[model samples]
Target: MRRLGTFLLGVMLLAGPAFAAPLAVLVEERARSDYADSLPPEGAFEITVKEPPKGEVLTLAEFWMDPRSGKFLANAVLETGDVQRIGGLALITLPVPVPTRRLLPDEIIMEDDLTVMRLPVGRVGAYVETEIEEVIGKQVRRVLTPGRPIQAQSIIHPLVISRGDRVEISFSDGLLALRSPGRALSDAHEGQEVRIVNLISNKTVTGIATGAGTVEIVQ
Candidate 1:
């Protein structure tokens, strides 16, 4: 086993250059609103770099705009110990609008002079830099693509649950009783679902409810 481990380590070292280089492609946008406002609001402007040349990892950095003009300057470091060459760059532009709201008199008075004057009116923008690499080890070769629009539904789960409800709990063979303290629980019903949370690992599992205050985890 030790010999096998050493062999694997040697192989990894030999392939380090090809695998260690970071070539990340990221999507960035600016919103002209306060934290209380909804994020990624409709019609918000966005800028994207669809495809960036792959290179060894060095330093990836970005700078914010002057706020007066929606422009950003980006820079990157390559594994070849040289800065990225300027050219063959692809950029994507999206136009988004900002919404207006009433600000409290106190809020207006507490603003910083620099930020207050540069406050975004209807549009904002950002620049992003990422270190990424091509996916490897898979049977099929896949091109590395970034800035793909992520569907909102992908991260959302459909469940009907409300706060402060009396609920039951059941496990593999034993039934445990617990109360809901007005928190997020997936849609479940009596004698229909079972849920378990592993506090140590912060993992949750769902199963079936067999009876009142009793749940049966379908292993």
Candidate 2:
């Protein structure tokens, strides 16, 4: 590993005439990369080149320095392809949505439960939540730690109506509207069909659960 870094540095120093003067450089590479699909081999060399070829982007470049010296300086690379000397503590972080408080399993999610904050990008997953609407009203599928990134699979559409619950059955056609007290024969969520028992007529009917404690007759 050391030999490869040294070889890269030697090649980079020879990139242009500006770095021809004998000098030593220290460098570090980001091991993680951002991508939605297939990610290419993780690499993009950023070396201290006094003057890289103007208007031309360098690809497959390398940087290295002699290891004989006991002293080495710390440095960081910026998004604009600039090698900067790190003189003090630089907290590298990435923006991501995280839970404001610890969330227990099966807890209904609310907009106030989450907040966007900066975290180490490497520790965040590709499917981390990015918007408030994504998690709002969702049911927590697993326990979530406070201030930790919320993943897509951590929440789900909650079952609005559970089994054996009383519900208002609504039937409508044209200008006619009728409502009857009914009991849910099976658990269901919004927009899902459930078997309902009309309490007044004592007859079973299938309807779509439309809201809290409510269902619409299919017919």
Candidate 3:
């Protein structure tokens, strides 16, 4: 009896979590004005869900949980119509189709059999909300949510260049040139910061000449 009780306790501990279902949620359809006076046709608008598991449903509350948190943090009202008949079982999936007209700023639109509900959006399991707000009308607004955050280490532009600076080019041989606004100079003055553009390879190189007509190509 003692061994049986210990075995039963262990099975209960392991099975408890398996019986708890994850909170169901869906991402509401989002819509934005294109800055035109006339509204685009209803069918012309669409919202794309980003990040997370690609096929996971987008729901108001689920969108708020920071994925890094590793906790399912949101919930939603599921519609019977959105439920699918799979092998005689109802299965819920990501991106249950809702109409485009229901999305608002910080809100997600969901559909039922009779009407659509626009509810405040929330984060999903372990995910944090990173939505941006934009004004659409005198009193209307919209939210722009990015799929992922931009990393600080990603290079977007050249870091070492500045405007109105000299660029130099050196040839494999002892030839040099200076490139400036609207002109190129082959005979550059010594110790002058010069700019050079390679005509063959179409690359720009820069350096200060050590002497007059003595520019040597750096291998």
Candidate 4:
């Protein structure tokens, strides 16, 4: 048994680069450089080392990538002055915007109400928001949990004019200005088109909501 154990130890020592921490780091750096344009400012890549290169590990001299296959190729210079070809598979991670705290329905989202988190690209849903700017100042449509990615449909622009509210519809062409009383037929955010029913004419018209209770007729 002692001799068998000794033989196993010898074989293990003969195996090069038992731990591939350096190789993992080098692969991550290559991913960062290759995916720089697609990554957000605070975004980063997470590399999972599935297969570590086998050789007398020394230093990674060169690195390149095959983005389509999510594979990385590299050259490791061994102590024997020989270059060893190495390859690895990695999973890329992406950044997404999330709420910083539990947000109640209809609550307005402020800049401080949100945070950013990284998730495996496969874990991010198609409708999840990835940019913070897309969420800030928006109204929460449903409850949001802390550190969880917010779905695109869960947040919306704050409504400036609500349905059934009295609004003033204004039309102006520099030389002429006119205002008409109307009732909002639909809810709308500032600068969004809203359906309004003219109080005097008893007809519905679409206009852009310019402010609180104010709709502008573009033409």
Candidate 5:
């Protein structure tokens, strides 16, 4: 009788995995559904069921989780219609903006140049840009590799005035206004300061780049 009982226990242990597999899928799906609203479109949760409930669970009736700790509790209905509680932990990933191809400095980021990638929340850093909109229309300040998170300082507004370009320099003190042709000594974006050499006076001065090939001297 002792040997027979031991054989029966071994059979139940062998059958445990078959029951656990289906329950694991259900649990993972429930966790994803519970946090759908907070998740990005391309984001998902990687669930690890620490303990599969010890019962013949037919279906999950309800589920919920703590967003902070990633601890989840589910109310499952057993085959016998009995309600059982199951708990586990999960690791969630979020979408981050990345370049679709290798981008070089001075290249402007277009909609097609950017895409989203899923990364573990802990791996994303504060220096990275999270949204595609944040990168679009911005010019690359440094080389960006494909599928890598873009650093915040890796891009800037497209330069409106390039070095050595002829620009119209304007000076105004409310009462007096004068405009002159000058050459840009440095590349500058809109509203950024640039050094300009006056074509007529043969003198160098600093001014703010107001538009394409245009600089406004304030001082």
Candidate 6:
């Protein structure tokens, strides 16, 4: 391997001048705005030169580019007849999840409820969860259908205490404890505040949800 590498280096040194040519490849600025699912059109690039290579032909190849960022990949090809040069650019994409079926209001989301999709970096919204783990097991906040992107506002933590259920109300300050039965006026998950109507007195009060069908009085 060492002898073959030395021999190749010598050949390259001898032929260095023959391949020494000056060339410039520039992607037009509009490419940044024109990127999408399709490759950037040929008109999105411009090549400039002062003089033609000495008895050499310039060959410029089409480039594969990301549609979202209008940036090309390292596969770009540039060749100069008398002066040789090459340049490359790389772009990144984002992986996002979309609902595979209709999610109704009050329904809980599950792992099989969504599908992963690849989107151009800029097309992804900041409030959207990029992975399924962040979305699955959450309760749907409203109606969403197939192909709709999942947003942070579209879901919520599974409710430990849902609305209208009979729950045990407890009041405590660490030293003393009191317990009573109450009716929840609204839905609340663990650690969330909710309204309850004391069953005996019929008085409304707000309390923190502590467990399934349980609430702790704030005062």
> Which numbered prediction scores highest in TM-score against the true structure?
4
Per-candidate local distance difference test: 0.32, 0.61, 0.29, 0.77, 0.81, 0.65
Can you write out model 5's per-residue Cα lDDT over 149-173, one digit (the tens) per residue? 9999999999999999999999999
Q: What ranking emerges by TM-score with the best candidate at the front?
A: 4, 5, 6, 2, 1, 3
Model 1 clash tally, residue pairs: 13
Ranking 2 against 4 by TM-score, winner: 4
TM-score each candidate: 0.21, 0.52, 0.17, 0.67, 0.62, 0.59
Tens digits of per-residue lDDT for model 3, 1-219: 234334444554576632322222122121122213332132222222222322222122222322222122223212211211111111111221222343334332222211222222221122322222111111112432223221222212211222332333344544555433211343344454445555556555555554433333444
lDDT of 1 by residue, 1-219 (tens): 234334444555586633433332321332132222533333233343434535643443332333334444444444443444322221223332111332221121111111111213232334211101111111111221222211122221212232223334334434654333121244444444545553344456565544433444564
The clash count for each model shown is 13, 3, 31, 0, 0, 6
Instruction: List runs of model 3 lying over 4 Å from the truth.
Output: 1-155, 173-219
As a TM-score, model 5 comes out at 0.62
Residue 109's lDDT in candidate 2: 84
Number of the top-ranking candidate, with lDDT as the measure: 5
Give the TM-score (vs. native) of candidate 6.
0.59
Arrange candidates, best lDDT first. Answer: 5, 4, 6, 2, 1, 3
Model 5, position 205: C-alpha lDDT score? 97
Regions more than 4 Å wrong, model 2? 1-95, 117-130, 151-153
In candidate 5, stretches whose alpha carbon ends up further than 4 angstroms from where it belongs are 1-44, 49-89
Give the CA lDDT, 0 to 100, for residue 11 in model 5. Answer: 59
